[model samples]
Target chain A: MGTINVSREYSVKEKMFLPAIIQGMIITLKRFIQGFIFHKKYTIMYPEERRNYSQRFRGMHFISVDENKVENCTACFLCETVCPAECIHIVAEERDSASNPYGVRKEKKPLSFDIEVLRCCFCGFCEEACPKDAIKLSRNYELSILSRQEGIYDLNHLKREVKGRG
Target chain B: MSSYEISKSENYLNYCSDKIRPLPVTGPDAKPLPKMTLDGQVVEFVPGDTIMQVAERAKVASRIPRYCYHPGLSIAGTCRMCTVEVEKAPKLMTACSTPATDGMVVRTRSEKVLKSRSGVVDCLLASHPLDCPVCDKAGECELQDYDYEYGPSRSSFVDEKRVFPKSSTRKLSDKIVLNMNRCVACERCVRFTDEVTKTNDLVMLNRGWKKELTVGDEDKGLYNDYQGCLSDFCPVGALTWSDFRFQKRVWFLRGNASICDRCAKGCNIEVHSEKEIIYRFVPIYNPKVNAHWICDEGRLSYKMVTNSHRVIAPLLEVAGHGPTATSWETLIPVTASLLKNSSRALLVLGTDSTMEECENLRKFFSKFVQNGEIRYFNGTGITTSSENKALDHLLRQNDKTPNTKGVESLGLKPLDVAGVNGFDTVILFRSGRAGIPSVAAAKNLILWGVWSDEEVRAQKNVRALLPGLATQEKSGTFMNCDGILQSFKKAVEHRGYGLDVTRIIEKF
Candidate 1:
């Protein structure tokens, strides 16, 4: 548990440090030649051009909607149960009989569904646990917000039209 | 009051009965109990039990799948989900209907039996709506249980499921909602209404593919008083209790054993609660008390404990502000001064008070109110144990309060016809079971034990209010209408500022 200090004499090559600096300069020159001379671009303009990520990359969350813009989520609570961060909160209520179009299948709907984006670990367990394939993790990773309240997503924000994982 | 006097009594008979099997004793004539082999284990069963019951007695019923078979209901082996292979029988037999014989051998998990169960699930799921996400019984449904155990991962039939449009949104009673498409056609609810309640209010309408459940008389609807029990035994989400329809998912509740204080029957119940909030009360199986069923009144009486209007904080009546919330520090001394200043005080104990509570109140008031007339009031309309009778054939009692007999056993007499007229101060204490009595005579009034804000506002000359725990949140003993003693522990923590009897007494 005690600290030990050992001293050693430096060799001439180690103390001069000229060859070490030259070796580092050669590595940097190789990368500069590949980028400046060969024109192999390593960075892209974020707003104009975007890099493609794998389809399985989990980022923001969205609820899938049907043709009539109705969300497929039945407020099953599978997402809330499987969430490790416990960020998902849902309040379920029975759908109005007069307005329900899908009979008994979608008889219950979420009165309020909220997700604290800041608290979510994005482990993708919610996507795996969902039975109706309603809740999904999309590939849109830009999640920065100006206000603390904007980090919390409501049902209306989640039900926006998401096109092909974007 | 000492801590020993307020110690919560636990009913250890049921809680500690796990993992200990009873020894099979012989009769006086020296005949051993009947034995059967269920899934390689030798089990001793009663004389006239089915093979399914024998498997249940062996604690190996989980290996067998079931839809129509419920232990509380009568046998109707129509589902064929519980089919088992017999050693020497010609064909597979339904375990629910086949009686167990001596040395009978049965295999519940054989390949042939599993294939049969899988086929049964297929047939049952063919017409099922597959709407478990929206169903209230999703987590605890028996049909879903059997389907997961022995069913196909993917179905072959691609045709559309038949839908009963009218019966999909059927209302059997104000307490029950029906959705026929979700039913597995097990006929458990129909038989429950017929055999248990004996009401014959429900019946199956059609045959085979068109089979549907409906009230016997369409015009009359369901007339049974025990309609809540229908939702309990339903294997599917066909019938649901309206009170718990969309309140919470079943998996989120944490259950604790408690007694129903709605009546004197002392029905053992499991309080399903989450975050100190009670979602519903379900009956725990106790053959000595309520057997697998509770009346609608007792099942729904838990709302009184969580009512928003209940006075949860200690209150002191200011000169002009009326009964306003105040801390225990200020209210207790102010209350002690009020009782000390009054020349004569009358203490009224509600019959709803527990045995230990009544004793503590008697000892606490004896020091100050020397000439105080102490009396027990049961405003439930019955005066004595002889007058308390059964209101129905089941658990309902004519005397509404739970512990009239227990209070009377403490040698406390009933309130006089003259009431508390001459006393300068009147102290009334109840645990929410007894009715309010006449407090018009006294100049100074004190209320205790779970009163509502509206109730306090209605009463005049109220000096102080002390909120006390509800029965579910407190431990107490009751002498039921049958003269049987029952004790219960606190099921949930008190969410309000209410204190126990011992804690309240210590403040003084």
Candidate 2:
């Protein structure tokens, strides 16, 4: 294929870039006047204030806890199976009989439940696949991590008190 | 070893349940078999075969569901889930107990039959604890499968369900755990212990709604080699293998065909694994080998591969220190030089090796080493195949290695009874199942194949270690104790830095 360059000579108005610069300055001046005088702001101070996201918005995952602070996850692996990004990993173990007075209802517990937030696509399928309403995606979207290892949320982190999906 | 089709073997014919066998037609006195109509399909069966058997012969056994009707166990006709509508009969007949008559028309999926099965499932579910999340047999449980297929969406019984609190999570044995609340009271385990194993270890304690499963001799406590089989055939989550209790959910696993190498029986097994990590070994229904059972030893043999101390990477000894993990690049040349320098080298092939491996090593050693003598060593009590005996009447054999007969059939001579005495360099090759031979007198020892850290550390003078694949990780044929040649595909990928014998030899 031959190249067809649509190169054209600049007109006098376009060649003189002073008008374009002045137009850009006028728009900036209008925004400055709106913000400085009228006190109209488009963005907030992110550290002090937060935006309101939809209640259904899928963010970081958390395992719901019961009245006694015991995680509701039986580690049925439904979440791990439904995860599209393959980020959810769980190890299941039998709950000790001494601590498990609830009998078959809470007989199994997750020995280790890990979610790699870096790899998670935040699809919220794990929340839907969970039978006991154990794993749910909370509205806490601040997921900054210092290291790659910090991105993996363990059972302890996942079992944090998430009051009504945060 | 002659490769024979597993389906046509005499052991398969013998192992087949006599209650549900096809009529003999080969002999001169053989006559045409009786025929029956099942769900509009005509199927041939022996005279005494049940309606379930006729449907099985026609490959439509799934049309009928029975909690108590295991092919390997005697028919109890207690579940009443296999009810089918026979045209002439006034009431629905249980397919598992009723013998098929010639020219009888049976409708397995009739509305009446469906209602009857739904009723059976509803009754069973009335007392069945909804503990599938904690149940080990959740994915493969027959009750769950039947409930999904033929059960009512909700039960009518609102009364308090029966609960045996003491027996709910009772440990029947070290190998099995019994959850009485989850049982459908199929009594398949009791029947299995009574008929198959003849151990009489388990029994139905009470009668009717309060019927419970408990060890016959509480102190004896399920003392049977085939205790794993009870969990295998249990229709519900009542009896579960303790080893695989909460290890993994069955639906997440992927199964591949393999052979158990813990004994010479060579039971065909389905290696259930996920992401190259094996979770458990369940027996594949091979009538010629392990009909429907695998011993606890073989069922739990995946630990050998997944052992934490297993040496995966190749190792080489430093100046005076013990074997240290090293790359194959540096270890191969060093091993070849050691083999070349030794005046008399002996290669001891562990009888656990497959036929192809033995052949490969025998051919490789003949051309590779100067004065190398290759010999087979089965350090598991018996040195030769002739001395190997059955530990039990069932699957367990006296020979711990899987392929002693196979290695012996290769024309390889057994090592001297005195063990490795005067060899300059001794190469011991195994696949983790074979016992280690005494090498106290050897100057330099080269350990190959699957070895744990303790095995390598126990040796006096170990020069180098070469890691190889376990039985489940590699594809090979085995000559079972019965001289049946069964070839298995690779079940799982080797989760290690181990190399194949052929590749290791090629690299050298």
Residue B263 lDDT in model 1? 82
- Per-residue alpha-carbon lDDT of model 1 for A1-166, expressed as tens digits? 9988898999999999999999999999999999989998878989799888998899999999988898889998989998999999999898898998887778788999999999999999999999988888999889999999999999999996777777
The per-model DockQ list reads 0.60, 0.66
Q: What CA RMSD would you report for each candidate? A: 4.7, 3.1
TM-score of chain A of 1: 0.80
lDDT of 1 by residue, B378-456 (tens): 8888767678888777678878788888889899998888898889899999988887888888999999998887888
Inter-residue clash pairs, candidate 2? none
Considering only the true interface residues, what is the Cα RMSD of candidate 1 after superposition?
1.0
Instruction: Please report, in order, the local distance difference test score of every candidate based on alpha carbons.
Output: 0.85, 0.87
lDDT of 2 by residue, A1-166 (tens): 8999999999998999999999999999999999999999999999798898998888888888888899999989988988999999888888998888787778888999999999999998888989999999998888899999999999999897777879
Q: Largest lDDT belongs to which candidate?
A: 2
Query: What's the TM-score of each model vs. the native?
Result: 0.89, 0.93
